[model samples]
Target chain A: MSLPLSELPTDTVAKVVTLEVGQDYRRRMAGLGLRPGVAIRVIRRSPLKGPLQVRVGHTDIILRRSDAVRIRVEPMPQTRGVPADAAHPEVVPAP
Target chain B: MKRIALLGMPNTGKSTFFNRLTGAGARVGNWPGLTVELLSARILLAGQMVEVVDLPGIYNLHGFSEDEQVVRRFLESQPLNLLVLVLNASQLDRQLALALQARHLGVPLLLLLNMEDEAQRLGIRIDSAALERALGVPVRLLSAKYGQHYREALAAIERSLKAHPALRRADRRALEEDQHIEQALDRLVQASVHAPVQLPPTLSERIDALLLHPWLGLPFLLLILFVLFQAVYALGSPLQDGMEVLLGEFRRSVLDPALAGLPSGLRSFLAEGLYDGVGTVLTFMPVIALFFVALAIIEDSGYLARIAFLVDAIMQRLGLDGRAFVMQLMGFGCNVPAVMGTRIMRSRGLRALTMLVIPFSLCSARLQVLLFITTAVFAPTTAPLVLLTFYVLSVLLAMFTAFIWRGRYVNREPLLMELPPYRLPTLRFLLHEGWRATLQFLRGAGGYIVLGVVVVWFLTHYPFDAPPASPATLAGRLANGLAPIFSPLGLDSLLAIALLFGLVAKEVVIGALAVIYSAGPDQLPGVLAQRLDAIQAMSFLLFILIYTPCVSTIAVIRKESGDWRLTLLAVAWPLTLAWLVSFAFYQTARALGY
Candidate 1:
């Protein structure tokens, strides 16, 4: 189902199924490793509001809550329950 | 010799196309007067040498940006033996506008439609011959990304060049056919080329909704900025530390003993002064290089365009556009190229606004100041925040200054920009661009760092008098004199000495301090290794971030704007704001308890 990132619960890992965003915009997101079928680990909801920092394919790409809404995602199976921010900083190979 | 100019919008794979045609010999560089310059190369066709020029990408040949003028001028001046107009297949309408413009220029043209593979994947199609009949030129559907269909294009060019004498239009019949041709395009599209041109999915709509929301966007944008700065601090520091170790080894192993056997004066001159000055500053190259590499990935992947789009409204409010914001982002890497890049903006007013605002972006040299200061005072826990705050302040200062400057200059153009489809940036290209940027930074700043060190050395060493009473003897006193003007800004000590040295090159500020602080009065060095305090150090960093950009940027501004008045304004306004902001920070921090 469609949902804004701000509406998505914290610590949700989801596979991006589709993005209603424009082609140019999608290309930009895809550049940062957020493509259809790519796994995204939602990091933190700004205590103030909106932009969410999510780790996709090892790079942390920030997206506004509104853009997050156009993306359709199915929650991934999660057992570790590790918070995005508290997750240990690991050096992912540069994309 | 024959001539063909490959022209189109930015990110249309023009550079890639140029690379494919000429390999590595094309003169590729940011334009001298513009951030994006036209590239010219020679291509050999069937044993005949033909010159191929790649003009800077332009949405139109009209009055949008400076590069547009360059493109318009080039087209107007020469009889292009054949105009090779490359259009992104996915974005045909806009690309067609340029094709129409080229046709109007009265040159025999060929439409090299690129990105066909992706366009076809998305279910788009083109009746190549039908389009050719409609536009009165040949159309080649080739994917420049993979080499498919490229040979055909080469063969077409070779044939066109060989038949060059007959290719030139003899009369106005072709020009008069354009209106009839326009109708033909409509009818032909209906009959032959049928495909879906749906808006490609993008996060921009949602991001723009949130980012442009009156209430949410600004704060969210700020928060993202906070995180970006935090990342810069978080990621860049360790790299910087490693660089420092390498520099230390170099100094200890090669520099120190090499000068030891010389006369005491000469030994100290080369060792403590020249070697120390340049070496100390150059140590930060690793951090600068890594930052550019990260930025290049973001840029090449096209994510950077989305950022400019998301922030366009805010920038517009400040009298700029998304393109201008892209240049501002590049300013963080270096203001010289950033200022030059203002050519991407479509309007003269907007171009000037972007150039004027660039100095406020915290470049790598300023990062050296931030890293050195924050590490000195706050523990790692607080250091990131201080660094973040400095960056935030610099941005705020830049925007506020832009707003004030906008009172004088304004653009009436719409902020609408074409966004290229995002693809993953290739690793090979990213590394190439990263190394290119790094080498440029080193080449531009490294020399100044060495020169600054030697000059400071001469000022300190040549004075035959007894070493004075102050910690900094000769040059130190001069710096102290200059320090007072900056003292009201909260950096009273010989730190002003370091800041003055920075006027030569920002990175040298730390090196200047390292030398001035390390040496003693009697010209006999003291054992105490001194460093700057955190609070005052932060103030110094803040000042450097806001100061006028280096001479190179000023030169670019003069060339781009064609007016010294605007250039002088760009230089003066930023320095004034920087001085004011640093002063306020210093005074407020002292009164609060720091």
Candidate 2:
């Protein structure tokens, strides 16, 4: 099932499916290497609906949950032997 | 002169490398309508004259922030001999995409993988030669902080500048719009980078378990702030005292006697104007150095970024993000750099608003003013409480102003920041970078303070015919004219003049008081106490707390925002607010018979 990235529980691994944001934020997220189909692991979320720490590859970014709510993602099962060490995951390259 | 620019994502130690190359001699070049300036310095590299510009760090050139736009514009517009791409070697998975993009720019590229030590610690390795071949650029391992293999890096830079090879335009497209990193980035990394499978966890992760703990994070932050301030004041106060004593002794023994031969007016000008002005700047060196050095330590250790995370929620209520809070915290040491630091914000509106809010921080200069009033006006027992109250009021005022201004500058930009791994701050690095920051503070604020002191001294000492700033002089007349308006706030003519001259620097308030009273610094505080009661003292203190920010701050605001409206608002709003608040406070206190 797909859900807003912000709704994904902590420690859940997910692949971004849709980033529904304005042109400006969309470009910013992309600039930060966050785009549709990129894999992200929810590292930790700040308290009281604050920003969330998400790890992509070896880079960790602190993204505001308010902004994160606009990006939709589907959780990927941990059963596979993929996501090597998780951070710096070997997902398919961006087109 | 050969011109080169350092390009990198944030936290790559690009600035550290720049500092190593060019000690503190940077000319900050401001972009029209942008909050940030490009810092460029001229240096001699291997007997060749070169100009090096350090661009603001950006995740991607086609990014959305004003920082990104500025970089893109510079790369597109400026003539450059070489583009040196600095990367955090430990995080090359994503940083390489930036290198790939810059390669598309058709600039002769030299890739420097910084933080080589950290990469080795984490069991990540890169074959610099292989990567060099894959990208067709010279790649070198570097430890920016410790300057490991520094000579080799310099040799590489000199070689690239000399070669200035014609860039390969295989893609034939220079960072085109909507340019996505193709499989090339992965291909390069797959060829050159190796990482251990299921790597051992780092100490940073274990520490974050406690430092970033949801509930404990804030307490740890406060504890860290508490310890930091205690350490700074504990160490800085003694150094400040030593500087003050040395300057004062030289002035009495050497300067005063030397100037005693001149005519009275000229002597007084040389003595008070030059002495008080320049002396104040020199006296503050130790405090500013120790303060910034301690700050660099914490920042270098990487806790400052986590601070942004912990403080983000509180900042959101003010219509700001965590990054803005980190900049505000820096203002407590000095407002000039803090205002300059606002360039990190992505939204122009958010940056402007953050700039406005930062001047309200009780910076070290203003902290001296608060301490002065507390010691002279309040009893010793109440002094600490009074200072604490002032800090609280400063915060409340900043929050209140942001709450009001956010409506006009409301921005919904995303807050994206990198949380770098924690590492020990090297002493060698702290001294180099911290001393550089202190010199910057001096260069920015020094002349303004001297000018203020000279102006204050002239106004208070002149008419040559009058008894040193008597009611007959221009300064006396200013006090007389302003006294009528200010007396209601419980300040007399002299106090009003001191507050007026405070425009240059908050610490200048005490200097103005010393000049106007014609008493030595020691005697002036005593004279101050005899003139104002506790009630009036509180009123005057409150006024000082919120008055127009020092001239240096105002100048930076004008330069950074490039908008006269915002600059004037910075000056005018504080004046009105200070007046209303002090008036209300003074009246209420008198009514309550305090």
Candidate 3:
């Protein structure tokens, strides 16, 4: 089942399924390691409609909630640390 | 001289390392890309002079972030003998990509894995030998904050300096062909490093629980800011007073007698206008240094990003993200750099709006002016409180301006900041940052303050025989000409002259009075104290707090925004707003019989 990343509970591990945004926006998101298939978890959310703090692999990223709504994530139950192929990989390479 | 540049992800302690290597000073902020400009220092490496430059940090190679663009510009323009890649060892898994990309730069590389102690505590370990073999470059561990393995790092630098010159861009085609880095990294990490599945919680986490707590964080942040201004006064005012005592003694005994040879009017202007004007500006050095301690702590500690996070909700409402608050904090030091800071935002509209709001922040120079006025006018117990009132007004004015202008510029661009874990700041770091800030104030605002004082003194005291500040004087005539505009702001002609000179720099607001009042350094405040009653003092303080920023800030606004019209709006709005706010307050206070 897919859901908006913002709707995920804090500490719930999930994998990004799709980024419902444009090419440039997706590229920017990828720079922060939030592309499709990264295992991500919500670290916390700011109060009163602020931003969401998330961890993709070892790198933590703080992004606004509205932006978070564009990302679709699938809950990966029973995993505290699902290894992302390259959630801000050991090396994202030249590709 | 050989050149080496340190490049890394933000908060990797790269700047701290640069400081130790070259003994140079620059503002280093925890928020990513806060370096904003290139900083370079000269040091002796391998018994020869070497130039060490610190590149603005970036998270990715291809990211279009301003920092990445800056790094690209540096690489395109400056040929380097070596690039020292600094990485937070604790986050090596995520940071190594930049390393792999930097390798493509064709410059010989040295991998400096900083924060080794934190990494070790987190049970993350790297086999430097194996990684060096795999990457074909040297690897070394560092704790930049603690000065750990510093000597060893230097030795490594010397050893790498002997490496054959890289073909550099000759490898561009090869870099383009480079692919499948994900699997390569997976294989590399498996062979060379023990990667953690999840980071173990540490002290930073516990602190974040309270500090980043939604309900508690905001209030605690406000309280901390309140205390910060108070602490600045508590620590700075005494130094200012002691310095003033010494300067006053010098002015009274030494300066007065030396100038005695001149005629009375010129002698007074020379003794007080020239000497005391500059002297009063200099005595603020200690206070300015003290003010930087707050900036130093916020920058050095990782809490700057946290404050941005804390205020993000409110900032979002104003059509800005948390990062604009970081620039505002930067503005507390000075607004020119803060205007340059708007580059951290991607949207052009947001940058314009942020630049508009930032000058309203009470920068150190302006704060120095306010400090003198408030201490002179308000009782000791309530002086800081009065300053706090002005500070509050400054913030309100910034928010109000942002609120009013957000319709045109507020973009809800997502804030994707890396909130680095907080590090404990050292006393050495504090003193180093304080001294740097003091020098910066002298450097950026120094010339303007001098020019403003001299010009104001000449304008007010010219026709050499005219009584000081008399209507026949140039400054008197100018003020009389503009009195219709400024008089409503509750400023008389002489005070209006000071305000006019203040456009060059706010420090001259105090410095200008030194000339116009023809009083010695310590006595300018006393003169103003007698002239300005409570109602008038509040009105004047409000005007100073909200008036146009210095020409330097205005010039930067023009350059950064690249819109002459917007720049004019920046100047116009503040002057008009300052008038409206001060006029309302003065009229209301007077109507109520104050």
DockQ category of candidate 3: acceptable
lDDT of each: 0.62, 0.79, 0.75
Tens digits of lDDT, candidate 2, A11-89: 7778888778776677656555676666777878888778888876666789888878888888887723344245344
Question: How high is the TM-score of chain A in each model?
Answer: 0.74, 0.79, 0.81
TM of each candidate vs. truth: 0.66, 0.87, 0.81
Query: What is candidate 3's DockQ?
Result: 0.42
lDDT of 1 by residue, A1-95 (tens): 64444455666766566777775455345334355654556644433343455655324455655577787766655613443323322232212
What C-alpha lDDT, on a 0 to 100 scale, does residue B403 get in candidate 1? 88
The residue pairs that clash in candidate 2, if any, are A57-A88
Lowest-scoring 10 consecutive residues by lDDT in candidate 3 chain B? B27-36
Instruction: Name the better of 1 and 3 by TM-score.
Output: 3
- Candidate 2 vs candidate 3: the lDDT winner is 2
Question: Which regions of candidate 2 are displaced past 4 Å?
Answer: A78-84, A87-95, B21-36, B45-47, B127-130, B148-152, B165-173, B323-352, B363-388, B407-413, B501-534, B550-567, B589-594
The sequence of per-residue lDDT tens digits that candidate 1 reaches over residues B1-594 is 677888887667776677789865565445343434556778687787777888877655553345656765565555667878888776563246566546776777788888888678756677787788777888898877687899998888777776664334313343223231233223444544555523333454355446545457556655654555456446766776677787778878987777668777777776766766666555545555555555665566665655554565356578876667766765785565566456545567777777888888888777876676566556779889988887898788778878887867787554333344467766656565545555655554455556655665565555624342223466567757766677777665566655555655577666565565555333311211124455666677777787766544555577667668997897788778778878888889888998
List the lowest-lDDT window of 10 residues for candidate 1 chain B: B521-530
